[model samples]
Target: MTESDAATASLRPTDAIVLTGLRVRAHHGVFDFERENGQDFVVDVTAHLDLSPSAVSDDLSRTVHYGELAVEVADAVRRDPVDLIETVAERVAAVVLAHEPVHSVEVTVHKPDAPIEVPFDDVAVRILRGRS
Candidate 1:
């Protein structure tokens, strides 16, 4: 494997907390009409961290609370609208990483109802972030 690949693999956490198909209505788009009307945006997030502490102690404090995380992510998306899903993805990642236990995060912002001329299933932006 390449040096970079090895480094990435080594840094990856073994356990994860995944939340998917979170739909939120937000005004985020370049077009004025889209911002005025608003649309549903789907977000998926995976937070990687060591789950062993919570597993062994059965203490909620030992791990990130996914329910709270979901709310934060939704709230982040609903905040001031930006034209790009990339920005939304970054916001979500920041929220996830804010939880001290999270070692890394994967965020996907899906714009299924994006204003597109041609028929398409969906448009999404996915990003990965970790502590440096």
Candidate 2:
């Protein structure tokens, strides 16, 4: 599919797998400590694809293997050091959408302990990408 196709693959109730609260310690930030000392980043991913094939065959191979997908996401998050959460989210989305069944990806990166001077509960960046 083209970029537009992936971009327009809106989430539907029937064919989506959601993973949430997958926290990992990663060095991603604009400041020195962010890369050097690192921090906890919480990732939430929604993978959109047709589940009918898997549903009919009752085969794990027919669907996205979320267990392996989670590992790939965590590795992507913790391994590389980026200055922006947007990049991080994109990387995660790329991994999720790599599967043929996944037409689109939704990634949310949470920086709860962001180095903000103001008092706040959390900060996060969310993005959606379609198959490229």
Candidate 3:
């Protein structure tokens, strides 16, 4: 395996949590109509934490509560008026990393129905952040 692959493979089995397809209506875009009209945005997050404690203790307190995290992300996305998905992804990552259990997070913000002259499937931005 490559060095990075080997390093990732060495981590424990339950060390990460993934949340996907979190859709919300948010007012973020470069164009005025986009901000005014608002559009649906989808977020997918992978949070890295030491999940062994939760696994062994069988305690919810030992891990990040994904439902609450999803709501937090949705609420944040709905309120912000940012111009770029990159900014949205960064903001979401910061929130996830704020959790005590989370050591790092990867956030992807997908704008599937973005405005464009030509046809396309989707547009998105992804970012990775580690606790500091």
Candidate numbers sorted by TM-score from highest down: 1, 2, 3
lDDT of each: 0.92, 0.89, 0.86
TM-score of each: 0.92, 0.90, 0.87
Please list the residue runs of candidate 1 whose C-alpha ends up more than 4 Å from where it truly belongs after superposition.
1-11
Q: Against the true structure, what is every candidate's RMSD?
A: 2.0, 2.7, 3.5
Model 2, range 25-112, lDDT digits (tens) per residue? 9999999988999999999999988889999999999999989999999999997799999999999998898888888778999999
Q: What is the lDDT of residue 118 in candidate 1?
A: 100
Tell me the lDDT of candidate 3. 0.86
Question: Which stretches of candidate 2 lie above 4 Å from their native place?
Answer: 1-14
Top candidate, metric lDDT: 1
lDDT of 3 at 97: 80
- Tens digit per residue, CA lDDT, model 1, 12-112: 86899999999999999999988999999999998999999999999999999999999999999999999889999998899899999988998999999
lDDT of 3 by residue, 1-132 (tens): 897766565432347899999999988999999999999999999998898899999999999999999999888788759999888898898888889988778889999989888999888888777754
Residue 88 local lDDT, model 1: 90
Question: Which ten contiguous residues of candidate 1 have the minimum total lDDT?
Answer: 5-14
